[model samples]
Target: MILSAPSKSADAPIPSFDQIPCPILVTDSAGVVQSLNQDLLLLIGSDKERWLTKSMELMFPMASRIFLHTHVWPMIFRDGQVREIRLQLLDSGGNSLPVFVNCQKTSQEGIDRFTWVLFVTIERSRFEQALLESRQRTENISTALTKSEAFIRGVFEATSEGIMVTDSDATIISVNPAFAKLTGYSQEEVIGQNARILKSDRHDADFFLATFEILQKNKIWNGEVWSQRKDGSIFLGQLSISAICDQNDVVLQYVVLCSDITERWDREQLIHQMALHDGLTGLPNRTLLMERLGQIIAKSQRDSRQIALMFLDLDGFKKVNDTLGHSIGDEVLKTVATRLSSLLRNTDTVARLGGDEFVLLLDNPENSEAMAQIGARVISIMNEPMQFDNAEAHIGVSIGIAVFKDRTSSPEALLKRADEAMYAAKAAGKNVYRFAE
Candidate 1:
């Protein structure tokens, strides 16, 4: 009996090889193509009849053919399978098309055959380029952030002014090296402490409350502040406080910048004192004396009170200067100033108007009799002998008095009136007092 091969059942479906998504080919071990799917025909834009029985190298570019001989064939023969080998094929339009080729060795009817699956790799190349670009951008951002942080830290550490950062609650969060040096407090001592730890008793509660109110409204405050160091010494500092805020306008932190200005403040005060006071006796000079007299005059007029002005010229002062030198004369004058100051009340002012000339302002002296008594006492004190450096000096004073009531006279007018009265007293015998006519 003769047996026939089983025929495919009409009811069962046969899967078409052309329906595979990837281009596929069947080849012999000699690299000649035996069959190819319709997908392969579309990929190369050619008909299957033209590719059948043709060497696979005929479809590849020169470089791809060489790579196939050197790498793909040897790997496939050694391992019976090769995967992910990239190559280019020439299409009907003569354009080079990149593809990933995977091959597996198989047997059909006891003859060795190779199956090749090729995938177009255009989208994958584009995705890989985009991934590389994204990675580079991320690296660049990280590097920039690092550099910015380093620059800020350098400024904080290197600045001469103290820098302190605190939270919204005024708890110290961080301090720079300059802050530690200025305050004499280490970072370990100040961190987590209230900012008030550095407060000196110089400012009251209202001062801090007002400062905080200004900061809340304007977001910054600048002023001079007295702060105590860890060693309990107080220093004046020019301080600036700034509020750091978030996107929602909520206060996140407070930055305090401060520099010690104690030396500068002291120097300024010294300059002011030198400008307004006499260099010899450290007493108020003519400028300050006149300013004070003006204020007193205004007050006396408002209160309907009386003020006394006395101008005195020292007698025998020039003889002392000629006999015992100007140094001894200066000592005698300083001694006379001390004795006169001792006799007056704290409210009174005595100023020297150059050599041997002095002015005294007495606030609300009782009557002309009281003014005469003060004038007599000044003359008695001046007549007493003053011993300086083992040299005895005798000097007397010629006193003139000018009294002012609630009048509209200017200070300059009252002063000139006193000057005229002084010359009248000098015309009268010296060492005597006379009242303004």
Candidate 2:
């Protein structure tokens, strides 16, 4: 009976080997399948009895199929020990699935030598798919972080305003190129240092202490102040500072944005000069001169003081202009203005009321004699000839003096009286001074 189990190693098929849960195949040393379990029918999708008896090589025609015949067969045939291996098994449709297989030889008395068992791997396939998806998500997150960092770097490198990041303790951590250019400090010199290294000392200790105390309570500050540049040149700046905070409401860092306003200050001063002074002769113009005269009139009315207003006109200026052009007239007028201005007190004001006409505002004059003395000094200076571009030009003055008593009420009326006296002086010949009634 055992004679039917063992044979020329190929003819006899193992009996009752077809009912196990794991698929099993019994083959001889020649790699021919002499028998297979019932599970092999499900694994390979084949119910044909002849397939169970076919060679194991016939089930797998892959290039690495030699594993079953070479390493597996030799080990089982020589040592009688089971060998474990990892490989793929081809199904009836030629789709391959990975499996772990074990092969061994049992002494069947007359049975074939090598038998192998294969277990299907359903859970391992799902686990491997999950691992691949996890790795793909991790790679995508890493790429996004890299792109965000590159974009932030470009913003820091390209911005015009100096940018710096400091911790809550005021330690400099990172800075941009504009910060280095603005502060005259290099990155190597500033990083990891306290931010006070850039302090300009423009603000006093108490000023800064009060400012930061307010900021610590409110976390923001915006204002204008003076600052020192790289070469210690003082400049005005508009500054804005803010604090960045975390989710827990703790401050993370401080951000400061500053803009230079020195040019704006210069322009403001220029506008003031243009408004208050004459552009040509650098003297007070009509508008500011009137303001000063109004102030003097008010003061004289209150204090019971004597004041004087003088209106001066160049004699024969029209004839001079007709002969030598307005350029020489301007030089003559400028020369006359300079001569008359030198005779006034510091409290007095000299102004050009426009073309060949000027006004002198004398504050608290002691008497009409003093006013007449000032008028005489002006007349004497005007007698001296002025040097022009081509020749010496002589001019004379007609000065009208108006004396204000304790009750002089209006600057406009005083100016009108002075002008009338000046015209009377002009009527009196050319080089003379007269007082208004």
TM-score of each: 0.76, 0.55
Alpha-carbon local distance difference test for all models: 0.89, 0.79
Which tens-of-lDDT digit does each residue in 1-437 have in candidate 1?
Answer: 00122448967554567776778888999899988888888868777888888998888899999999999999999999899999987877877888899998987589888989888888886787799999899999999989999999999999999999999999999999999999999999999999999999999999999999999999999999999999999999899999999998799999999999999999999999988877787777778878888999989767877888899899999999999999999898898889889999999999887888888989889899999999999999999999876799999999889987538888777777888898989999888888988
Off by over 4 Å in 2: 1-153, 164-174, 190-219, 243-253, 291-308, 363-368, 402-417, 428-430, 434-437
lDDT assessment of candidate 2: 0.79
RMSD of 2: 9.8
List, residue by residue over 202-244, the lDDT tens digit for candidate 2. Answer: 7889877886886777888788767766577777767677788
Which ranges of candidate 1 are over 4 A from the true structure? Answer: 1-135, 297-308, 364-369, 403-413, 433-437
